[model samples]
Target: MTETPNLKIPHGGYVVVGDGRRALVLRNEGHALHLALRVQHVFEAPPNPPTREQGTDRPPRVRQGEHRSAIEQTDWHTIAEERFADEVAAALDRIADAIPALIVVAPPRTLASLRQALSERLKRVVIAEIDKDLTKLSIEEIGRRLTDG
Candidate 1:
């Protein structure tokens, strides 16, 4: 975590806490002053190893004229993370109709991916975006952080 923003999650508001591998959606059950979050949905992606482990063959060779050039190896881990972002966006779209407002919390890189995956209507529902990885924190601890931090 870098900087903690002042946040007040109103009742019926939703918070999407995620990173590259996990996305946890929580709904606020209490008022703005007292935040009590209840887990509504969770998306946990399968473990994605590094490119070296996931890739079987070496970099592909491109033939140009008489010389051969090796293309850069693909990053499987980054691809998996991007796909995970799409899944999270779909989940948020599914629950958007029920939420009054939304707050998104993710690391800087994941946040950009999520922002791109989310729909226009769903984007409008987002009231705050906190660039931090709060997925590992307990629900109680998250609530405390939102209210106190």
Candidate 2:
């Protein structure tokens, strides 16, 4: 496992813990040695069923003369995740300037979605990006992970 660099989140910096469904925005009031992370905002998306559960019908088949082709079914679950990431980015953009620095923690796919959704200006302020699903972690645990090796 690659050790994450010890993060000294500055005052007013944000640590966004998220996955495909929800995001917890935490702000650091204290410095590197004594980190105090307070949840500033919480964003949650509507629950989505699995792709198979969502799609009731089978994939449609097209026939051209003697040739037949089957098209891939749409992945509803993935689409929902991408949309949620966009919503999260928009929420952050509203207070983009207020955030002096940002630390994003999400699953790999969600992280990629957030990367695309974030505004260019907001992207510049990002200090670290951890490809892990950290939304389930408690506030104190998240703080320890950010600071401790």
Candidate 3:
């Protein structure tokens, strides 16, 4: 782990943590903190092929039963990871520069991935890791976990 300097700890507040592809915004409530998780997707627009009849009045034809399931697909995990890494790097740059003393709380895997990608100076920033899976739990449940911890 790279040594980060001037780590700042907050008394209490809300922070949005995620890898861009997935994110959880944790906010402190009066009793407990609420966690709102979000998932983002980077979609590539398909190119429209040039046709000789560009000015034709014919509309695009619809192919029934030709749809493919985008769900239940892991073939693009690597691609998503790469894109997510890029997004994380950008976000970290902003965070490290703008909020040098911000306290970060995240899951173990997320912390590990962020640690590996963050700079030595940024690594010095303090973070708290919670093992709970925000995606699988409700906001109220996440708040309970945070308060319970």
Question: What global local distance difference test value does model 1 have?
Answer: 0.86
Clashing pairs in 3: 4-124
Stretches off by above 4 angstroms in model 3 are 1-16, 25-75, 100-109, 136-141
TM-score for each candidate, following the candidate numbering: 0.89, 0.92, 0.44
Displacement of residue 46 (Cα, Å) in model 2 is 0.7
How well is each residue in 84-140 modelled by candidate 2, as lDDT tens digits?
999989999999989998888888899889988999988999988888877888999
lDDT of 2 at 17: 86
Taking the tens digit of each residue's C-alpha lDDT, what string does model 3 give over 1-149? 22223322243433335542465544343321333322222223233234433334443454459763433323244345455545564565555654333333445655555555666655564455443345446555644444455
104-147 per-residue lDDT for model 1 (tens digits):
88999898899899988888888877888899999989888777
> What RMSD does each model have against the real structure?
2.4, 2.1, 12.4
Model 1 Cα displacement at 8 (Å)? 1.2
Off by over 4 Å in 2: 1-3
By TM-score, the best candidate is 2
Pick out the ten consecutive residues of candidate 3 with the lowest summed lDDT. 37-46
Poorest stretch of ten by lDDT in candidate 2: 1-10
Q: After superposition, how far is residue 140 of candidate 3 from its true place, in Å?
A: 5.4
